[model samples]
Target: MHRLITVALAVALGLGAGSQAAVPFYDTYQLQCRANFGAAFNLPAGSFFTSSTPAINNAGQVAVNLVNVNVPGNPPGVWFGQGGTGQVKFVAADSNATIGSISLNHLGRAVFPQNFTSPNGVYFYDAPSDTSGLLTTQPIGASSFGTPIVNDLGQVGYRVSFLGSNAWVSFAGAPPVAFHAVEAALDAASPYSFLFTPSFNNSRQIAGKVRLGAAGQTGENRPDQIRIINPDGTFTIIAHDRDSDPNSLFLSFDNSVALTDNGWVAFNANLFPAGRGVFFSNGVETRTIAVNTAGIVSTIESFGPAASASGLVAFRAFENNTALRAIWIGDGTTLRRVVREHDIVPTDLGPARIDQHDASPVFGGSITINRYGDVAFNAALTPPDNNQIEWGSGIFVALARTPGDVDCDGDVDFDDIDAFVAALSGPAAYAAQYPDCRWLNADCDGDGDVDFDDIDPFVALIGS
Candidate 1:
């Protein structure tokens, strides 16, 4: 029998060794955690309530706002969750009762409030050095560094809501220069409504929602639109359909918007009660995703695989209807339903409801997909406490397999490599070694063959 061998297999092996698929986000960290109290972070059994903001950095570090309710009031400080090391560390401590909610960047620097009384400002905590850097301390400007989103370039996006004017301020470099805010020119309804909801990508394009009016008497947001601000303070509204909906379009500002390096923004918009569909790669022109129709009307918790270095975003779009729940993979333009038999429970926030104090039935707490098309999501075991019960739910994180997954398992491993090898290997080859191999590119060592160079690495990293 003529044994078929792959040439330049070693070079292909080297190329495949450190290479990752083009995903929107990577699954570097995953855990099923449960906080003790109604709090965010589970700190010991007694003592401090450390509930972290849901924001996570590319490094898998999470920002935790430590509220010591054991002291009688809301005394908040900032903390960091090093997901890689399983370390939940304190970043900054508020002594004068000045700090507010915490925000962190991939570099692990945290931004919190600083109390000085003259020019109240934000402080950055360098967790690596345990030193604090003050952005501002005077109250004359009395500006806020609220809702901060930082990138690896040391550029920080914060809401400077001051003096009846709400704008976005991007701070770049160490000892950031006295950068002014990006003031979006509104057509005059209410100046206070211009809350700059920013999603900063590596390209320095800060995209966010700007409200047109103040909170309505019905407790509803009057009207708002999406806009993008470049580094030089120039901007253009990407989805400001003023003539479209009467009640405006986007509902919630938090976690309702996302941006990618490819000038793409993952947003939720409505075709006037066709209900809210989580749209991805929505540029100047509105685009609908291919998720389940039921999920289109439901609240999608997270978006993923993450923007690969090549700018591909992968995420499981979760939808919960009164009767059915489904999870789908959402690329920029297409959403492919992955699983339809998922059972969804309401989150801490309840079942998905339009008006009133009810929680949206969510498919999961948090969702992320890696460049390898590996899907991950956090699901709630207990229904949200909108019913006001003290029963805390267990948040379990799960993962899904990708298309190149030749083994049909939730991960890429030796079986997958073997299957890939078998596909690349011909009939006259050693078929017994990799009968199921399907991925031809995985045959790294070539020499017209698939051997240990491919199998060892694939088997060694099943959990990675």
Candidate 2:
């Protein structure tokens, strides 16, 4: 039966009658973090994460911002730790300053804005050297700094707001350079009047949203645009408000955009006609990952879309007609739910429900995904075993499974061959055969598909 199946598959996929080239084998390793609510790092008792957004690097290091709610006058601080390890250390804390959103790079370095401080500026903390310092002070004539994102090369990108102008700047251990500034001519016909949500990738490319036209120009309802500034200082518009084009599907985009190293940008936007959804584009083509529908979701949260270099997108959205929310990951064709509100999560303390509080205004949790597919996030949890000790909000990482593990049995072997073939048949057949496994496990090449192209890679995993 195995021989017959192999011959049929070879014939169907148009493989010639010859020995196939040796496909590189990717070693299967257990993820640093488990699917359970295992904390990436432990927080002090009674401390809660203030910012739901946590950043993760490809090395499985996680960083977050939190505050000690039990201590009066206690300052919020940024913390860093390795996934699935409890050894966590503080990056920075100040009683007189507030820490903004934190971004981490593969070097274990984190960058964030230290607000309300003397010489308020964006700061960096190097975990290996145990050192922290300011990266750049506020640009002259700037009122504040937006969230700063650090790339692997130690370059930082952020938005600076002036009295009446805003600009996106990139810093590389020296003076900052403004790549795009308000009142700068976007084209011969208009100037960019507004910029928001600047992001950086390893290629030194910057992506963000912009409004074309003069600042405060009346009767100018030009839709916002998503643009990228390339390494050569050239610009490319990924998507824009093209309401006049009958073929354009996007009506308007929200203020959130996430850029991946592979030059893909993920965002949330209002769809044409009426609805909201999460979509991604690579400057040439755009694809939808999820959209609000009657029974699936009522609204997709605009603030929590994250992209990965492996061509995956993660997002948060509310369940239809319910307050419950869920985190989902997609590769354009396949969507998987990572977790949801009220789901039980097993922790070091015990099992707890993924919960939220009315006091916390952040509707859905913030999320981030790395090149390796690991997702780091922050969430409030109901105390395990009804015990509040050492419990409140926590940072966690959901590590991705090894490639070609179609059965998701922790290892790739002969046991997965049938399931792999089923997955190649289609997602429905794969799910019908392996209800608990993910169809994405068959995406061996990591090109976001399960087809004949993955056959050699899958064979390499189990040996020729």
**lDDT, candidates in the order shown:** 0.45, 0.68
What TM-score do all the candidates reach, one by one?
0.59, 0.74
Once fitted onto the true fold, the runs of candidate 1 whose alpha carbons sit more than 4 angstroms away are: 1-29, 38-42, 46-52, 69-74, 83-88, 91-103, 112-120, 130-140, 174-193, 211-224, 242-256, 282-287, 290-329, 333-464
C-alpha lDDT (0 to 100) for residue 31 of candidate 2: 25
lDDT tens digits by residue: candidate 1, 1-464: 11222223332344344323311222122432334455533343222322233444444455444443333343445444543223234423344455554555667676765443334566676767866666653323635546565566766666665554556666665444332233443223333345555666667667776655543212234455666667665666666533324564544433346666567776655444445555554445555554334534254434322333323344444445443344555454434544332243333333311111224443333333323443333333333323334333322222332433444333343345445545444443534653432243344343334444654444334323
lDDT of 1 at 51: 26
Cα lDDT, model 2, residue 453: 90
Q: Which ten residues in a row have the lowest lDDT in candidate 1?
A: 20-29
Question: RMSD (Cα, Å) of candidate 1?
Answer: 9.9
